[model samples]
Target: MMRRAAFALLAAALLGPLPALAQDAPLRIEITEGVVRPMPVALRFEDAGGAGELLGDITAVIADDLNGTGLFEMTEPESSPATGFDRTVDYIAWKATGTEALVTGQVALEGDSVMLRFRLFDVFAGQPLGDGMQFVSPREGWRRAAHKIADQIYARITGETPYFDSRIAFIGESGPATERVKRVGVMDYDGAGVKWLTSKDDLVLSPRFSPDGQTVLYTSFASGVPQIMSLDVETVTSTALTRDPRAMSFAPRFSPDGKWIAFSRESSGNTDIWIMEVANPSFAKPITLGPAIDTAPSWSPDGRHIVFESDRSGSSQLYVMRADGSEPTRISFGDGGGSYGEPAWSPRGDRIAFTRQTKAGSSIGVMRPDGSGEQLLSEGGRDSGPSWAPNGRVLIFTRLTADDEVPQLHSVDITGRNMRPVALNDAASDPAWGPLLP
Candidate 1:
C-alpha cells in the first residue's frame, strides 16, 4: 500500500500543456534488459612523459563511471605488484585482491598525437578477453580517449551498448520559490561538463532530448501560459511547438519515431492527452477524451500503446491504452490509500517507473506494465519523477527536502542500490532522459 500526499497545490503550479516537438521520425532500437554487473579491473599506468600525470585522473574517471553503475570496483594499485601484459604476470596477487578482471594500459607520444594501448584480462582464466587496442588523439584529448576506452570495455564485457559518451538535458533552477529562476541546462549523464542551454528569466520545466540528441522538447512559461517549445541543442535556438489559446499544454513527450508529439492539454477544466504531427502543428488530435483527468503520457517502445496516470477510478492510478485512446485499463493495484502519478514507460517497454506516495512519504518506484511486481526503490523526504537512464537498469529522479526546497536530481539502480546525487550546482527537477547519442 502507498500513501497519498497533499499534491494538489504543487500539481497546480506545475500543470500546463505538455512539451512540444518537431516532426522527425523516431529512432527505434531493440529494448532489452541488462543483468550482469560491470567487471572490476586494476589499471597500472605506463609512464609516458607528461601523459603520465593524466593517468591518475583518467583512470579515476573510468573507475567512477563503472562503479557508479553499482557494478565495478577498482583495485588499489599500491597493494598489487607491478606487472604488464608484455612481461611476467602476477595473477595470484590479483586473485588475492578479489578482482576477477584486470586492465593495463600504456601511453606513448606519436608525433603530435598521443597513443594509448590497453588490454583486458580474465584473471582466473589467465587469458586476454580481447586483443589490445590503441587510441591516437591530440595530447589534450586524453579525457575523450579515456571515455572511449571505458565505453569499449563496457560493451565487450556486457554484450550491450554503452551510454557513457552520451549527454543529458534538464532544467536548472535557483532562487526562492516566490522569486525562483529556471533555465535549460545540458550535462554528461555522469554529472560533468554542464552548460546552460537557455538564460534564466522565463520559467522552464521538463527538458526532454530529441531522439537524435540534436534538439530538446520542454515546457516553458515565457508566454504566460505554459507552452511546448523545442530548442536546437547545438545552436540553442528555440521554436514554440504549439500556440493554443483555449488550452494550456504540458508534459510533452516524443513518439518513438519522432513523427508525432504526445502531451497533456488542459481544455476548460479537463486535462487530456493529445498528439500533433511534428510537420504540422495545426494537425492535432486528442488521444484521451473522458470525464477523468488523463496526464503524464509515455509511449511504449513500439509506439503502439501509451501508459499514463488517471483518476477516473476515484483515485489516481496507472493505466495503459492504445495510442488512439481506446481500451483503457487500470494496471496499478496495491495497498495504502496513496496514489501513483507521473508514469514513464521504460524505453525497453518491460517496466514503467513512477512516483508513489504512502503515509510515510513520497518515493520513486517501478512496476511491470501489467500492474504486477511493483517495488518501491527509494523512500523518505520527497522522491518523485523517475527518469530511466539510457540503460533501463538505472533511474534519475528528484529528491525534495523537508522544507520544500527546490528538488535536486539523484540517480539510483532499479534494485534500489547505489543512490547518489548528480553533480549539478542548482536546484533541478522533471528530468526527461534522451536515448544514447551516436
Candidate 2:
C-alpha cells in the first residue's frame, strides 16, 4: 500500500495540473500549414436578460473574430443544435450537421454589470473541448469583453497566443492626393474606436507604438524638416528627440524591451541605421555604417539581432546584423532578380515577412530566419510593409489596387491564404502593430 501511495503521488506530479474537465485533452493542432477546408463551427449566443440590444452585436463580434482567422466556417445560429448558454448540449445533433465544433453562450445584465459565460465543445466526441470560462465587466466594456472572449477561444483552440486585444498605430491619410494631410491614428485591431493622435496641421509618418503601448514614435515635418519625435499616447503630448537642424531622422521602431529605439538618420547625402536608449536620445550611436543606404530597421524578438533593408548590393536587399552591429549577412534572395524591402521580424522569432518587388508585381512574402522557405503569400498590384499580428500567424500590410489608387490595410495568413482588406478608412500606409493590451 505504501508503494501504491508513492506511485499515485508520482503520477499526479507527472501529469501536471489537470484541466477543469479531466476527460478532455488539450487541442494539439499544429497550424504550420494552411487548411484547404476550414473546420465548420456552430455558435449559439442568447440574450439572457430580455435579450439586451447589445447582445447580438457582441455575439457578432465574436463570430467575426473567429471567422476572420480563416480556420473556421461558422454556422448560422438558427440552424445550430444548441439552444442557449446553460442548456443540456445536444452534441450528437451538432455533429449531425457536420459541424466539428460548437460554441454556446449567454450575455446577461445583473445590477448594472455585464456577465458573459460560454463553453466550447467537440461535437462529434460529445464532450466539452476546452475549459469553460466567464467574463464580468462594467456595461461600457462590452466591446472589450467581447474581444477578451474571442481571445480566450482563439488561444484555447489553436494553442497559440491571442492577438485580438491589440491596437495598430499608423499614418492616417485624408484630403486630396496632391495635398494630402497625414497624421497619426490608432484603432482597435478590428478597426473600431479609431482615435487620431495628431492633428493634420503637420505631416506625420511611420507611427510605431512602444512595447507597452504607452508611447508612440513617429516622424514629423512640422518644423519644415523631417525629424523623429515621441508622443505620449495617453497624454497627447509630443517632443522632438533632438533639435539638431542638420540631421534628418525617421522610420523609428522600439526594441522588444522598450529600452531602445532603432531609426534611420540621413546626413551629407548618406543614410544609416542608428540606435538610442529610450531614456537618453543624446547617447544615440550608429549601428550600420558606410556608403549604402540602410533604413527600416527591425529588432528580433530576443533583441540580439537587427534586420533591415540596405542598398549595399547595388540593389535593395534584406540583411541581418547583430544588435552590436557585427557580422551583417544578406538574407533576401527574391525570385532571381527581384528587390526586397520593408522587412518585419515575427514576434515569435519563427519567420520574417517582407515586400518582394519583382517584374510581375509587388507582393508580400515570408521566409525563415535563415532565408529559406520563401513563400509569396500575396498576389496583386502593390503590397508592401508587412506587420505581424501578436500571434505571428497573420500579417498586415499596405495594399493598393493600382499605383494611383488609394492604399488600404490588408491581412494575409502566413500560409498564403485568407487575403482580405481590413475594414478601415482607406489611403493609409505604414502600419506598426503593437503588442497585445493588458
The most accurate candidate by lDDT is 2
Runs of candidate 2 with Cα error greater than 4 angstroms are 1-35, 77-79, 110-112
What TM-score would each prediction reach against the true structure?
Answer: 0.85, 0.89
On residues 219-279, what C-alpha lDDT tens digit does candidate 2 reach at each position?
9998877899999999999999855679889889899999999999998989999999889
- Candidate 1: what lDDT? 0.81
Best by TM-score: 2
Name model 1 segments beyond 4 Å from true: 1-40, 47-52, 77-79, 85-93, 108-115, 136-144
Clashes of 1: 21
Determine which window of 10 residues in candidate 2 has minimal summed lDDT: 17-26
The per-model lDDT (C-alpha) reads 0.81, 0.86
lDDT of 2 at 18: 62
Which pairs clash in the backbone of model 2?
A: none
